[model samples]
Target: MAESEERRGLFSEEDEGDPAPDDQEGEPRTPLSPICDPSHLLHRIVVLAFMCFLGFGSYFCYDNPAALQTEVLQDMNLNTAEFMQLYAWYSWPNVVLCFLGGFLIDTVFGIRLGTIIFSLFVFGGQIVFATGAIVNHFWLMEVGRFIFGIGGESLAVAQNTYAVNWFKGKELNLVFGLQLSMARLGSTVNMNIMGWVYHEVGEVVAAGHTTLGVSLMLAAVTCLLSLFCALVLGALDKRAERILHKEQGKTGEVIKLTDVKDFPVSLWLIFIVCVGYYVAIFPFIGLGQVFFIEKFNFSPANARAVNSIVYIISAPASPVLGFMVDRVGRNVIWVLCAVVATLAAHMMLAFTFWNPWIAMSLLGLSYSLLACALWPMVAFVVPEHQLGTAYGFMQSIQNLGLALIAMAAGSILDTRGYLVLEVFFCACLCIALMAVVMLYFVDYLKGGDLNRSASERARLQKEAAAHSE
Candidate 1:
């Protein structure tokens, strides 16, 4: 009878011990389990699609001025120097504001608040620009563009933050590519249709034709749509936070300006690459329609058509290239390839009499490839808490380059010729290639694993997990 009693006591002790440990462990794992489950895949995709919508309007309005460049110059009776201010105004203010904006997103404001506020700036700026156009006040238009610049690039930082928040380490590169693709699509649609909108609206205004202001007003409508998407995304993000308990076990880190010092040498090299590559591309695009007209002797309409091929091809190709990067993981190699292709394209434009279409199409592809490969690396290197500031600083530098280069390129075109500008572009591409090479070496020395394919990275992740177990 005493032996039977002792056996029962042992069984009771085992039961109580198991429950104590299980209860302690289960609480933490409960919140994380849902995220790892495949069932949440649809939720993630929907979230990504919403994120894409947030930038669509910003991209559309940003490019509209370039799309209607000739019309704005002719209607406003402005010289090229004055007209280039439209781009300069959009770029110069963002030099400092983008960094601050990113700081706010990381610390003071958080992603949702920053995105909404920046988007509102975009909307308000577009509206003010349209009003300036209606009044035929050049100063007012410049002011409006300046205001738009305040929000434009900063909003871009917020968008990056959002993508990292939701998609980091889970097809992140591909998601960025898709976001860029959507943005480029907005620009492409603007290129394809802005001229038509201008002409069509003109026909409607009692046959006297509409003013450039009317076309601008139409672009403002797109800004408003983007603002609406921002609000919707904010709500959805909040809901997800609540449902997933994403913040339950987390502490908010205080973001400091000094955090900038922590970024690796590789990131700085990437920034220089970004500035060089974009200076070669965007400023050229800002001036490209004129290039086509001057060099190929094409009409304004035809020039725009040729210029837009970059955006048009990028709209579809960016996401695909991003997916390949996600699967393959040779981001640095792809970026180098892009730099080479861009250099070749500019050379053809500068030196050869080859069909501009061939050169333009190649440029479009290169632009897409670089974008998909380069931007995601920021996320890979920087901690999530600092991503906003990191992305912002990069934009600030990029904007500075773009602002200075656009103004200078305009002056150069007026004084020298398209050949000089094309040569300048080639020089920028060469510098980008050099920076990219430096980046590759820095990454290699750090064992960043950025040089590996996506599958290889995944294999490494699995091996680490097994070893830990």
Candidate 2:
């Protein structure tokens, strides 16, 4: 009987020691596995489409003034110097509002509300512009342009944030490239179509018709289209929430300027590089057609068409550079772009009289290379949580450069002449070259290779493995 009792005790101990069968296998699997399944891929497509539509709206407002500058001067009875001042008025507000928009989107309102509010400003600004033009009120036109800049600057920030939300680590770089490419596509369209529109409007005004009324009507249509696209995006956001359960959840806490006290020095250098590069580029984009007209004696239509070619080339260049950044590495592509841009700038300044078409073509390629490479580098140096704020800060700096250069370029053209413009271009190129050299020094200090950083390559491999599992 004692033996039997001992055996029973042993059985009891074994039963207690054994893990539950289900526990051994694994915890009960959640039925909601694959939370971010591709079943809702259509929603992502819709969101991207809407983003492109918003892009169209922003570019239309930004590029229209350039296309219609001559007509605007005639209608407002302004001289060249006054028109240049007006252009400065239009461009400066973007610099001021970029930081505000970035902070508000990330912290206060979130993407949806931020997008809607700013879009309203865009619509309202268009209306104001139309009214000012119809009434022949030049000062009112300046007011409208300022308001439009405020709204338009936010569009880029909002769309960039949206891309990060839906596409992070999942072909994200390509999506970023596509989004930026679409924005350029919008710019190209505006440059081409606005030239025709301006010609038509000028003819109408010359025939004693009210061109402003017709232009205003067109603006109304575009604004309505933008609103409709934003609504579609809203619906897509809801669908994404259903599929992914708060699909666009906050990645992390909003990083304030104070919080960035310890941000890496390399990041600050990157910011400076971006600012100098944009300062050289954005203002030139505004003045490119004018430059062509002045330097080449091309008609307005031809000049605008030539200018559009840059963006047309850029549309493909962005995605190609993005893909290369992903495959080859970011640093390699960035350095190459900077070097190429430097060469192009020198070529343009030196050879403008050799063949204006050749100069313009090189300029276009230079713009494409720098733009595609520079913007994507933001993704590399900043933390994902801080990307929106970081980008906003970068853009703010960029706008500062743009605003100063636009004013400075115009003033130089007015006082010192076009030869001064060439000197300024050369100076800008040198600044850009210096920035690239700094980037190289930073890379060296980090013991990083420009061709291939082993750590990043390994990280990419790990990410690929995770996705596969």
TM-score of candidate 1 versus the correct structure, residues matched by position: 0.80
lDDT of 1 by residue, 288-310 (tens): 77778877898878888888899
Candidate 1, position 113, lDDT: 82
Q: Per-residue lDDT tens digits of candidate 2, residues 1-469?
A: 0011111111111112111121233555334323333234554665667776865676666666666666666666765556655556656776656557656776777777777777777777777777777777777777877777777766666665665566545445566556666667667777877657655775766521147435654755676677667666666666655544453423232435653665666667667766665555655656667777877788988888876776777678755654555465656446557556655754564455665556556666666555545555554556656654565566666666666777787777678776666678667766767767777778668755443554686787699899999
Q: Which runs of model 1 end up more than 4 angstroms from their true locations?
A: 1-50, 106-113, 160-177, 204-210, 234-255, 259-264, 378-389, 439-469
What Cα-based lDDT does every candidate model obtain? 0.74, 0.61
Model 1, global lDDT: 0.74
